[model samples]
Target: MNPDIVRWSYAAASGALLALAFPPYSVWPAAVLAPALLLRAMRRAETPQQAGDLGALAGFLFAALSMPWLRFVFGPFAAGLWAFFALGPALFGVLLKRLQGRGDWLWVAAAGVLWAGMEAARAHLPGLACPWLSLGYAFAPAGPLLQAASVIGLYGLSAAAVAGGAALALAAEGKRIPAGALAIVAGLAWGLGERRLELKPQGRPVSVALVQDESYDVERLAAMTPRDAELVVWPEYQAGVPGGMVDRYREHLAGLTSGRKGVLVVGAATVDEQAPFENFAWVLGSDGALLGRHDKQHPIPFMEGRLKGHSDPRPVATPLGPVGVQICYDLDFEDGSRRLASRGARILAVPNLDPASWGPLQHSQHSGMAPLRAVETGLWVAKAASSGDSMLIDPRGRVTARLGFAGRGVARGTALLSDGGLTPYVAWGWLVVPLSLLALAAAVADALFGALRERAFLVYPPSPLGVEAES
Candidate 1:
């Protein structure tokens, strides 16, 4: 086969592998192999610019396939979003190729760190950022591996994956000894993770009921009675009251939880005649008193329209321990969840409202991320999606019970709720911050070296006729 054709084929293969590693297909091992294949494709490039172009092509392909659901939400703008985010992976390829050119084992580790930093940068962009599909997310299916997240967070796992891929690529190029050493280190890491998984979680059992309905109808609560529910949750935006109907809405909610001993966390679109509309989770106490509110903190970037997000999160005190309430998409980020946990929230009551328009593929993908939030905060997550995929997840990233995407149903289960304390992830969130700085330094160094190398080969004062120099 032609060398150019082989290089392009490898790039395309890398994209396909990465796409399959994410939800729907979720082939975990493919995530690691995709990075290795990308490294191989970059090795065929003669210059950093060439490596970047190939890397960008691979990234574009990966994003285009993996995020097809973006089309459902953003329509034609999805392609532009993909193009923008693909730049991160393209830059990663440029740096990895330049550093690995030295053939030093140390650079291999650096390459991995660089890749992880790239993922963090893509996720942290101010207004327009979607950090889904990180390399660490692929390992979510492996129970023991996710235990590391409680200590190092998700980006740490991404770094390890990138490093492992680099080691595998090196081994394929005949650098066997170093690759074997990395394998041993990885095995030990996994063993340590298993030990963490085996440790019993310290908490008391709390019976929680998750209600998933198309909308918050009076009949839905009137017809059903929970046997033993310490807390009852409804999906996000299920109760949208008119600007003049706050009093009536409160009266209805009061009636809903009047006799029940459990607190009701119901999603609402609170309308005020004086101010802008706010998305909130109204916390109604057992006696039908309004306990407080947890407003939606992280709404979908473009889809949210004009709805605003709250910056600080406060937990609502309840009989089942302090309960933290967040809406859909907030579970996808670490800040709101971490804040809720830090402020003494033992169980997270998530009211998700994934519209049927988003499709089953999006539902499955969204559900996969809930467990990671549980593991990161050491808080048992009770997620109720209106369309489907209502679930109960423990602190160990275990899905104790789940309802798939299709019809509306109630998910009733007992959750072990811990006394609120900061997990390692929340207490030490600075691990990735420094790693990003190191990656930035590496990229600057590679650019300098590449530029100097090109300068050395430049032909100045081209021919005897005072022609322009060849770059």
Candidate 2:
């Protein structure tokens, strides 16, 4: 077949295999589909170059399909970055295919390096840098498979996922050694994920109500004030206007507070002459007194607060719990989540303001993280979006209750607050970035070793004849 035809086939197949990688969508398709595509590509490669080309095609299509929403993030830059990311998967598959002849373990390991490195780069490059389409998420409901993330972070889960695909390729080819080894690794990941689901240092439950205020018009909000609700929770950017609207807005808020029997966490803008206005989550008592306020630590890149000023989370005192708040795009970073989690925050509340993004896939792509953030920190994450995805996530990364898009609804669920508090991930936030660096270094060392053994190294320690001549 023509090389062009083959590339097209690779792209189409990989795109098709990604059917269930996003939410409200199941992964039975991806689990079987992805491996089948990989197996086909693995068998098709007669040479390393051919394998890489096939891999590249697969990567490109994956990027185009999975991240078309990025175009909204930074316009053409989205496609450009996705195109760049697509290469990593292709290069990974191609390299693993080449190394497969050596041994199946080497094939899996090499692919791990390639795939994980790309994800690492995605965090470093892509707009707001969301890597939500990770293969591990396809099995997010399968708690046993996701526990590896607590120790190694998302990359570990990714490496395991790729290893599974590589094993499937080897298995199809009748390569027993690689097949058995990969199966063992997959089993181990499952065991770890299973063990951690019920594993809690602080085993108790807390009541949490996630408010989904959906998107509302600022103009309409300005013209007509909102009615009061009990123990009110509002979305980010929807609470108060951009400038000094707090005092004017207090009356409407007071209506919710004065009669309400509990606390109200309002997402709004608070301003001072000293510095620019900050997006804040104001905690008000039922009597309408300001109880505590957590200023949104991380802000949206271009939309709300400046990224430079707001990357770090700043928490405040609240009776319900130590309230930790973040704006949209802030949830993408683990550090911000950790900062809030560290400060005695039992529940993670995000007052998200989601604008209509560029494409359809972006919405689902963003929704996927609710589980990951919950799983990684072992904290219940309540996302209150001005748009949607207002949901309650348990410590195990399951969406116990969720609200649909653009709806005024309350999702109440039993979210266990940390009785003892703080998981290793919360205390040790992406200490794995450095460790990933180390793992990557070791992987590079092994690759270099392979090159030396294969005589692919250009500078062979001087030939014996040359040494004799020198003597």
Candidate 3:
């Protein structure tokens, strides 16, 4: 077969494999194999530019296969988003080709580091930066492997996987020792992760109810009593309760609150229509009083048109403990949740409303990530989604109870409440991103220096033994 044809085949296969690694399929091993295939294909590219082109093609294929849900969610604009995602992989290929050109000994390590750095950069790229499609997410189902996330966070797992894959690739290319060493490293990491799996639940217990109501009806609250739960949370933007309409819902909320002892967290669009509508998670007191409100700090871009995101995220005081609230996409970013956790938030209540059209694929993807937050902040996560996969995740990132998608019901569970101490991740998640950036800068500089040094050596070669003696 032609080398180009073979390379293209590998690229396409890798893309497909990566798509399968995510939700709906959740074939976790494919995540590692995907990058390994890509690395193998790029090894044949003669130039960095050619490698980048192949990467772009692979990325496009990956996006089209994996993220078909984006079209249903973002409409025609999904094309632009798909292209944006493809750019990261294209750059991934370019960096690999450039770094590999320098030498083989460090090429695999460099590629893995670059892969992680690219993922970090993509995550910080403002509106388009999606943390959902990250390579680490593929391992979310593997309980033992996910333990690595507690120390290095999600991006680090990606780096480790890519490194392992690259090592195996090198072995396939006739180097066996390095591959065996990398395998040992991977096994040790997994062993460490497994050790942490026996994490003891150490915190105050609190009962919570995650209500996934399609109608966002206040009437649903009639059944929830003080004995049922300490807090009841609804999914985000369940319905638009415009300004004039808010009074009626308030009346119903007041009735539900009277003589009760639990907090009712309602999600509704407090719409002004003329001004920017606020998507609020209103905390109604047990005695029919409005205690506090946490406006969604982060709204999904483009999908959430004209709704500006706010910066103030404080823990809401409840009968159980200080609870942190994140509305859907807010969980994607760490700032809001970390801030709340820092300020003594023991439990996290996330009100998510995923589209029914997106199906289990998107639901699984969204739900799988909540555990990372739980582990990162050492807080229990209670997520209520309007269209399924609602779950209660323990502090150790275990799913205790869950409701499947396309269902309408309340998921009742107990969440352990911490007194708010920073986990190592919360203290250090800020550092990983900067370090990744520096690593990327260092890689580029090294490549440039190597190229320059090669040119200098070519221009100023040492004289042959006899010629040097004459000189």
C-alpha lDDT of residue 246 in model 1: 74
Per-residue lDDT tens digits for candidate 1, residues 1-471, read 898887889888998898898889989878778887887878778877778888898889998988888899889999998898689888887777677657657767776778778877776666765667777878778787788788777777777777777777777888777678877877887898799788877778778888877756645753453635888888888776778777688778687556777878888885564667688888877777888888888767776656777889989887666889889888887677877887888889999988888899888888888878888888889988888788998888988877778776778888887665678897876556566757667686868887787787684433644443433
The C-alpha RMSD of each candidate to the native structure, in angstroms, is: 3.9, 5.2, 3.7
lDDT of 3 by residue, 1-471 (tens): 899999999898988998888877889888888888888888888887788888888788888888888877778988888788789889888778887756665887787778888888887776655676778778878877877777777787788888877877777789888779977877887788788788677777777888776666656634533445777787888646767677687776677557656777777787677756888787777776667778887767766766778788998876766778898988976667777887888888888888788877778878877887777777888888888888998866889988898988778988777564677777777787788878887877876787789889999887598787888
User: So what's the TM-score on candidate 1?
Assistant: 0.90
lDDT of each: 0.79, 0.62, 0.79
Per-residue lDDT of model 2, residues 1-471, tens digit only? 895576458556875576455554656337435745664676576766677677676667766766666677878777776677666666565545556666557766666656666566555543345455666566665677665656555666666666666667667677777668767866776777777776753544555565665445433332222223323456776664435556566666665335455556667764444557677777776676787666655444345534234555665565556656666666765667777777776667777766544333555556676666776776778776665777777777778877766555676666665546566677675665566555555655665677677675456654689788889
Order of the predicted models by lDDT, top scorer first: 1, 3, 2
Q: Report the poorest 10 consecutive residues by lDDT, candidate 3.
A: 218-227
Q: Model 1: how far is 240 from its true place, Å?
A: 0.7
Q: Each model's TM-score?
A: 0.90, 0.76, 0.89
Stretches of candidate 1 exceeding 4 Å from the true structure: 216-227, 244-248, 271-275, 430-438, 441-471
Task: Give the lowest summed-lDDT range of ten residues in model 2.
Answer: 222-231
Top-scoring candidate (TM-score): 1
Off by over 4 Å in 3: 101-105, 221-227, 239-241, 244-252, 441-471
